[model samples]
Target chain A: LAKTTQPISMDSYEGQEVNITCSHNNIATNDYITWYQQFPSQGPRFIIQGYKTKVTNEVASLFIPADRKSSTLSLPRVSLSDTAVYYCLVGEDTGGFKTIFGAGTRLFVKA
Target chain B: DVKVTQSSRYLVKRTGEKVFLECVQDMDHENMFWYRQDPGLGLRLIYFSYDVKMKEKGDIPEGYSVSREKKERFSLILESASTNQTSMYLCASSLYLEGGETQYFGPGTRLLVL
Candidate 1:
């Protein structure tokens, strides 16, 4: 499993864009970057995933550089409801479906 | 929508008592997992099952055991509940995908052992 590093916390106001970057220097060739959003007292929810370049979805966009060693999760026009912890995971079929999640980036969306 | 439902949202148990956390998924996914989340530890996997009656130990499985009697149901058992075992437990299910499996999680069970 590739170890990931992200910001401990980030502050953002409404209508502003929030981009959280994750670093996985040991990323493997078969690895895919995935982002999950977790609200207070709730399980993490899938936000966006990408292998390389950029992938956009209804909720957010994932920007992966050519090197694939890092990825960014961009949330447009954030709101207070978007305040949550975001986790970045990297792997694919890690023997016996073992997945690892690191301490996530806590995004605090202000009014 | 993929839905994973846990038996309880909040549970209080006494020390030395047996505890069971049940999780059921409606998607019929082949893989089901149990994870415990703490203040700074993030999410640590306890156990996972890829098929019925087959189980695998995760990173932290010392105090936890799991049983997957059927495809949609997976249960985590705590032989003797302790105060240190108090934490939020999350259940998830996913299908094995070539790109990456997207895990659907439940609301989580908050366990308080006193």
Candidate 2:
């Protein structure tokens, strides 16, 4: 499993764009970058996933660099309800199955 | 939508008492997982099952056991509840996909042992 490092916490306001970056220096070739969001007292929800370059979905976008050493989760027009913890994971198959929940980045969307 | 339901939302038990945490998924995913969340420890995997009657220990499996008799249901058992075991227990299910595997989680069970 590739160890991931993310910001402990972040602050954002409504209508603002929030970007959270995760570092996985030991990322493997087969590993994929995936992100999840968790609100208070709720299960984490899947946001976006990508293997390389960029991938966008209805909720957010994932930007992976060419090196694939890091990835960024970009949320547009954030709202107070967007306050939650975001996790970035890098793994494949069974290896990915483990360590799905590391210390995630806590995003605080202020009013 | 994938729905993972836990047997209980909140549970209170006494020390030396047996405890069972049940998790059921509607999507019939092949993989089911049990994890415990603490203040700073994040989420630690207790056990997971890839197929019926098959189980694997996760990062923290001490004092914990699991049973998966059916595809959709997975159970986490504690032989004897202890105060140190008091924490938020979570259940998740996932299926392997092209891009990656995404886990669907349950609301969670907050267990308290005294």
Candidate 3:
């Protein structure tokens, strides 16, 4: 299992773009970068995932450099409802299994 | 859409009492996991199962035991509940190891041990 590091908290205004970065210096070759968004009292929801380069989805985009040691989760046009904790994980895509969730980045979207 | 259902949404138990937390996945996933979420500590894995009756200890398995008698259900047991054991219990299900599918999580069970 690979350990991950992310910001403890962040603040963004409505309609602004927000990007949260995660570092996994000890990342393994078979590992993939996946991001999840969790609201209060709700289970974390899958946002985006990437092996390398960029992977985009309907909710967010994941940008991973060639180094694969770090990745960024970009949320476009943030809304008040977007205020939540975002988790970055590095693990083998075994059914998204065997993942370690770090402290995660808490994003506060203000109107 | 994958549906992972937990037996209870909230539970309150007393110390030294036996407790059971049940989780079921309708997707027929072969892998199920139990995790606990705390304030300062992130999510810590308590246990996981690859197949029916096959279980593995996770990062923080102390005082926690799991059972998987059927393919779609996994249950976490606390032999004797303690105050520190009170936390948000999460259950997740994933496809077999070879499939590399994403794990789907249930709504979670909030356990408050008095």
Highest-lDDT candidate: 1
Which regions of candidate 1 fall more than 4 Å away from where they truly are? A93-95
Q: For model 2, name the residue pairs that clash.
A: none
lDDT tens string, model 1, A19-93?
Answer: 999999999888888999999899999998889899999999999999988999999999999999999999764
* TM-score of each model, in listed order: 0.97, 0.97, 0.96
In the order shown, what is each candidate's alpha-carbon RMSD? 1.2, 1.2, 1.7
- Residue A52 shift from truth in candidate 3, angstroms: 0.8
Off by over 4 Å in 3: A93-97, B96-100
lDDT (0-100) at residue B89 of candidate 3? 96
TM-score of 1: 0.97
Ten-residue stretch with the least lDDT total in model 1 chain B: B94-103
Q: Go through the candidates in order and give each one's C-alpha lDDT.
A: 0.92, 0.90, 0.88
lDDT of 3 by residue, B1-114 (tens): 899999999999999999999999998888899989998677888999998999999899999999999999999999999999999999999754432357689999999999
lDDT-best of 2 and 3: 2
Query: lDDT at B76 for candidate 3?
Result: 100
Best candidate, DockQ-wise? 1
Ranking of candidates on DockQ, top first: 1, 2, 3
Q: What is the lDDT of residue A60 in candidate 1?
A: 96
